[model samples]
Target: MADIIESAGVVLAYGVAGFAVMALGYLALDLVTPRRLSSLIWTERNVGAAIVMSGQMIGVGLVVAAAINASEFQRGLGVGLVSTLIYGLAGVIVMTLVFALVGILTPGRMGATVLEDRDGRPHPAAWVQGAMYIATAVMLTAALS
Candidate 1:
């Protein structure tokens, strides 16, 4: 039906917007880390890098979902997509700023500490940093909603 096709189109548009935002999030994380994020996770098989990246991606997804939910009904599809993109980007910026702030407050660089593996295991700092990203996203999601 025409309605089904229209709904599919909206879904596609939202999907593209979400993907673009997530890509930007990845780039922001890459900028903060000491090494190339892709290389660290893929080539090096680094668990710590993987954990950090996973957390950030989940956080971005939550923000994007919240944005779409909040805007689609109230503002319609076009505004929903735009707001999702904007909110997702904001989430990335906040997460990056939190990373930097943690680095400053902590004894050593947060990024460097998170990426460290000790005795073939990920450092505890990695878990803490990863949780911080999720927590930041939750707060941003609340603000969006």
Candidate 2:
């Protein structure tokens, strides 16, 4: 029980670290670009959204892989390699589903919003992302153990 608890904590910590790193990277890119992200994407909301979400997909996969590594010290390397690849593919599918759903729900908003929306709203895309996340987590857990 204690081992499981510790493992969970480690995984969560790794996810936080990954998220922080990814956010910082995005911020740096924004500073360097110095242009409206939408403009760069030809003002196509869907295209810009896809590009941003693609980064998010990679970031989420990295965090998931890191978390899996934290959970298994001995076999972390093997599991990390496998999970990273699986999560990368899963992220692409999940992000595509997310952007599509967002386009449906918000109509014109898609990638137009300048501010972030992190409210705990019941979104279909969130559920999809969560499902993919959990499934990948479980696969890594099983592979390690």
The number of the candidate with the highest TM-score is: 1
Estimate, for each residue in 36-89, the C-alpha lDDT of model 2 and write its tens digit.
544544454333333454455454555455444544436654455445445434
Q: Count the backbone clashes (under 3 Å) in each candidate.
A: 0, 0
Best by lDDT: 1
Runs in model 1 lying further than 4 Å from the true structure? 72-76
Q: What TM-score would each prediction reach against the true structure?
A: 0.94, 0.35
TM-score of predicted structure 1: 0.94
Q: What is the C-alpha lDDT of each candidate?
A: 0.89, 0.46
| lDDT (tens digit, per residue) of candidate 1 on 21-128 | 999999999999999998988888889999999999999999889878876546677777887888788888999999999999999888899999877699888888
As a TM-score, model 2 comes out at 0.35
Cα error, candidate 1, residue 130 (Å): 0.6
